[model samples]
Target: MNVFSALRAFRELLPVLRPEWRGMLWSYLIGTASALSLAGLTVLTAWAVGHAVVERTPPGPLWWVLVIGLVLVRAVLTWREMDVSHALAYRVLARLRMALFDAYARSVPGRRREHSGYAATVAMDDIEKLEFFYAHTVAQLGASLTLFLASLVSASVLLPEAGLVVLVGGLVVASSALYRARAARRLGEQEQRERSALSTRIVDALGALREVLAYGLAPRIIAETDAATARAAAIARRHELLSQLVTAIRELVITAVVIGIIAVSSSAAGVLAEGAQARLSPAELPALVALALAGVAAISDATATLTRLHPLVAGAERVATGIGRAPVVSVPERPRPLPTGPLGLRFRDVSFAYEGRRPTLTSWSVELAPGEHVGLVGPSGSGKSTVIALAARLWDPLAGTIELVTPDGTGIPVAELDDAALRDAVALVDQEAVLFHGTVRDNLLRGCAPRSDADLTAVLERVGAAAWIGLDDELGEGGVRLSGGQRARLCLARALVRRPRILLVDEVTASLDPATEQAICDVIAGFPGTVLVASHRAQTLARLDRLVDVTDITGVTGVVPAGRTGGA
Candidate 1:
């Protein structure tokens, strides 16, 4: 993304950050005070030194008192500035994380194929990088500009020649930014990409650590991670080097300005002193030198900070890209209300294909009335799972609509219903239904509202998994200890608790034993709504009310009736 686009994305956080605006304002105020006070102290100390040297007299206690007081105030303001700004930034980070989560929940099983690892990286690491903005950008910009202006005005009052030189020198340092800004921006972009890739690889490796260990592929994963890290480091170093170069050039400009200002100020002071019939006094020498140096140094310091921040500013650009990514599916503004009770489903001419791929479905259609069970069986790569996904509206079909029907025959498009209503209307229990790293109760409650212990017990019993696990049993991450059948039953129990209007089971029974499979099928048979099963087992297919032959229709394949005997 271009700088403007990145900036626009950064501005999006303002709404969530509205509560922090007061804190941010205070931070900026404190920061400005701190910077100006420090500048003031520099000039005052210089003046005191010059006076003491020229007259051979020590500074009065009041002079020391003023300098010390300025120092104390500067320190206090600096502390306040960081404390308030960082507090505000962290709050914004939390808000951004919550927003991204909400976006994901609304857009999953996700519109396009995305890696779990990459999504995890976004949720964890990418959002953390945004702290740079909240902590530094707004307050620093305010503080830097405020100090520069204050210093410039002070120098002008001290001596016009000194002020002019400082102004010209500040402009020259700013000009260095123009020369290096483009290169820094480009390096920043490269560095951001490398960082993101490194994050993705690290997350992926960690998540698959078991697989790597099991297959003894640890060396390969390690090598890949090392390579990604190396690439990231190289890009980051380039960015750092460019920033240092900018700083050096800025310092060079400041040195030149200091020399010019001293030369002109000395000449002006001598000319004035001689005309006034007084020899040039040593007392004023250091004062003019300090005035010339102080303001110019402030400009250079501000310039250096801006240059150092260039990388972070660029990092924000990458974060903006993630935030600005378009949602795979567009949610309707005004959702259509779903059927009040158990509903039928129909797919009319529904067709879809992945981007840059041939169509998977074309002019295909199917219907299941309320409480009617249907089975969709297909060969590998056939659209059995795709059909189920489309019905769930994970992705909008490129053609036609999927509808839920009321008893009165009113049809509601799944896309038009609010996500909660649609979720209530259909449940998808896939083969890899993940159980989080928590108790069984936590995983089960995900399907519906939080349930009492009795409710959990009842669902577990109904799904025939209560005998194996309890509400308090830890599932470990991804249900590590649960066998295939146990995990499947637990997932089913989760779906059963919701009592959705339609249940879409995708090859969930494929890995279960005969007894476990029978138990799961019995639970499905007892459900009050439509049950659509995608499976290859004849026994599972035969249990359904009717068979839909996906092979006969475009975009629907691997489907056929279970012949009599049904046992395969």
Candidate 2:
């Protein structure tokens, strides 16, 4: 990306953190004060040295008091500035992290299986790299510019020629950033991609550890990860090398400016020029040199900060894009309230297609009246899950309206209905309904208000899980401690406990034993709420009030290969 685009990407992150502007402002002020104090100290010390050595006159008692006081004050301000700036950076990072998570939660699963590893890197690693940008860039740059200008004014007041030298040198140092700006940004982007790719592979391998070990693919994954790491390292090395070259050049320019300032100050003192009038005394020569050096050094530091931004540009872009991504599902400007009474689901000519693929549901239409039990039987990938997703409002349909029909026949479009109301009305229990790593009660009551043990016990008993598992029982990651059938029972219980008006089940019993499947089906059969089950099993389909053969409706063969016993 070009300079404007790179900067624009970084700028995008500011709004998410705008609420923390107070903290940022304090950080900036504290940091600026700290920088200015240090610069002032340098000038004061140079003045003392110049007067003492050149004129055999030591600084007065007032100068001693100012120097000693500044020293102590500078120490405290440095600590405070660091503390505030770091705190501000961390706060902003925390907010940014949450924003990224919110974005991912919305857009992911919609993107199918993209690089999960890359996402992780953005969330964790890439965000960490942004600390320098937040803590050091904006405030420090302001402080540097202010100091540079202050020094320039001081130098010019002392001697106009000295001021001119300072100005020219400052401009040269600042302009160095424009040199190879594109190269720095490109290398930074390259480094970011390589690192993210490497993280992706490593995370992928770790996640599929079972498959890797079972298939003896460890070596292959290792080789691939090693290669990715090497490539990333090489890119980083090149990036650093380029940075060093820039730094060297900048230092060379600063050195030249300092030399020029010393030469000019000498002439102003009438030492180098035979007939030149003395514009500055010999006692003030070191002070003039110090002012010029410090002024340009401030700008030099700012330039260095800009140069460092190149490494961060790519990561900033990723983070910005990730956090700035629009939600797949939009919240309505004026959400309509769900009509009171029994709620029925209706999908009228709904159409949706995934990215780079055929339409999953083409002009699809389905309806379920209150308390009606319907089963959708289709081939795998035959849009069964897509229908469930649309009904759940995970993603809006590309075309056509899906609404909830009220008792009075008022159809409230899902798009227009309040999200929380919809979620309360509809609960989905998919095949992979995961139990988080927590106590059973914690997972059961997650995000829920409150419930008594009696109420909890009643819900767990509905799915035949109360007998074995206590409310406080621990469930490992994905509830690995439980058998598939047991996990299914608990998952079903969790959904039922919500008392959702409309329950959407997606092959929840497909992998269960016949007995477990029957028990789970019994819970659904007993539920008074509206039910929609998508299953391939004959027994599972047989229990439903009615069945809709997807192929018959759409004139497309079943996407899932199953012995369809025909629609009920």
Candidate 3:
């Protein structure tokens, strides 16, 4: 990345703050007041000191009052500026997090290519690193520019020579920010990559802790993590060295500007030329120097802020990319409501494929009658899961339509239905029975309407989970504390809590013991609404009313009945 690219990245991200204009305005105003007050204090003290020393005049009560008041005002303004800017930054961060989450929700598992850990890193860590950009960069830069312009005008009015020196020196200091710009951006990007990779490794290790421990790979994992950390630290050290070099150059320029102002002030006061008429009074010399330095320092401060932004450019770009990801499925412009009553599922000549892979379903069609129970049976990797996912609208088929068929045989395309209505009508429980880190009730109530304790207890009882777990019992992260069967039952109860019109299960019983599997199958066997279970397990399929083989259903284009094969 270069300066231009960094600026473009920020340009893409800055629009997320449009809704916060009022807060941004307040932040800018407070920041400007703070910077001006500090400059005013410096100039006022210098003027009083010069007057007393060079003119033999004691300071008046008004001068003392102004100095004291400026100090107090500067302190308050400084604190208030931080409060407002940080508050505004956090609000923007929250919105960015939500925006990223929404993007992931729509775009994820598209081709199943994105790593969970990398996605988490982008959402949490990358977004967090942008706090400095949001909180300190924008309004503070504006405030610094405002102070520089104010001081320049004041110095020019006092003495044109002093103002000219300030302008030249400010430009030099500002230009220092561009020093090693390309190298800084490259190192920053490398650092970001290393950090994200390290986070991903750690997350992957934690998620597969049992396998790692079982294979005795802990030492190797630890060594690899240490190496990654060292690499990241080295990159950080290089960035720091470059920043320090720029700061050193900036400080040297500021020091030289001060010396130049002193010389100009002394010459105007007739100190360097004997018997020359004094154009500037000796008493104003200190104040003139102070004003010049303040003006130049403002420019330096702004440039320093810009220099620090190089390290954050990569993070900004990641966040921007994550937020702007192309959605896997398009939302309907005008969504039609689902029909009122039990709904069946219909796949019409559907053709789908994962990225870089052959088609999973080719011109295939299948349907379940309303209130009928059907089992989808096929060999492993025969697109049973793909069929279930399409019916649930996780991804749309590349060619053809999947619909929710009403009792009267009217088919409403799943893509055309309102998102909420579609979600309400269909529920899916897959092989990986995921339970979040929360109370049993929290996981069950996710995406469900409010349910009373009695209603929840009954659902848990239906799944045979009420015997071992209470509604308020905490399930550790990913239900680590629960047995496999227990987790499966709770997941089933969660799906049941929604009371969806169509229940889609995908090989959820493949790994369970025979007894537990039969217990789960019994619950599905009793569901009254339309049910479609995809499994290779004979016992699980035995509970359904009929079976449809995925391999036999491809190359067909019409509604195939639950028990029969269709023509190619």
Candidate models: Cα lDDT each:
0.75, 0.82, 0.86
Off by over 4 Å in 2: 109-113, 273-276, 554-568
All candidates: TM-score: 0.86, 0.92, 0.95
Between prediction 2 and prediction 3, which has the larger TM-score? Answer: 3
Model 2's C-alpha root-mean-square deviation from the true structure amounts to: 3.4
List RMSD in Å for every model shown.
4.0, 3.4, 2.9
> Top model by lDDT, which number?
3
Pick by lDDT: 2 or 3, better one: 3
Q: Tens-digit lDDT track for model 3 on 1-568?
A: 6557778988887777678778878888999998899899899889989999998898899988998998899989988987898888899888889888888888764466778898888888978877656666778888999999998899889889998999999999988978888788788778888999999999999999999999999999999999999999999999999889989999999999999999998999999898998889989999999998988998999998888777678788888998888887789999998889988888889898888888888888888779877888777878999898888888888999999999899999999999998888899998886899999999999998899999999999999888889999999999999888888898999999998999999888988999999999889878888998888897887667677878875522323344334211
Better lDDT candidate (1, 2): 2
Q: Runs in model 1 with CA error above 4 Å?
A: 1-23, 55-72, 102-110, 115-123, 179-187, 234-239, 271-294, 309-314, 554-568
Clashes of 2: 4
lDDT of 1 at 395: 74
Tens digits of per-residue lDDT for model 1, 431-531? 87788899988888885875689988998999888887889999897999988999999998888777788999999989889998998888887788888
For model 3 the local lDDT of residue 274 reads 89
Clashing pairs in 3: none
- Against the true structure, candidate 3 reaches a TM-score of 0.95
Candidate 2 residues 1-568, lDDT tens each?
6557767877888888888878777877887778778877888998999889988888999998999888998999989988888888888778888989988877764545567778888888878878667766778888899889998998898888888999999999998988887888788878877877778878888888889999999988888888888888898898889888988898999899889988888888898988889877888887788888888999999998877777677788888888767677878999998766677878788888887888888787777778777888879989888788888888887898888887566678998988888887888898888899999897777656588888889998888988999998889888988999998888887787777888899999999999998898788877787888888887776667777766564423323224433222
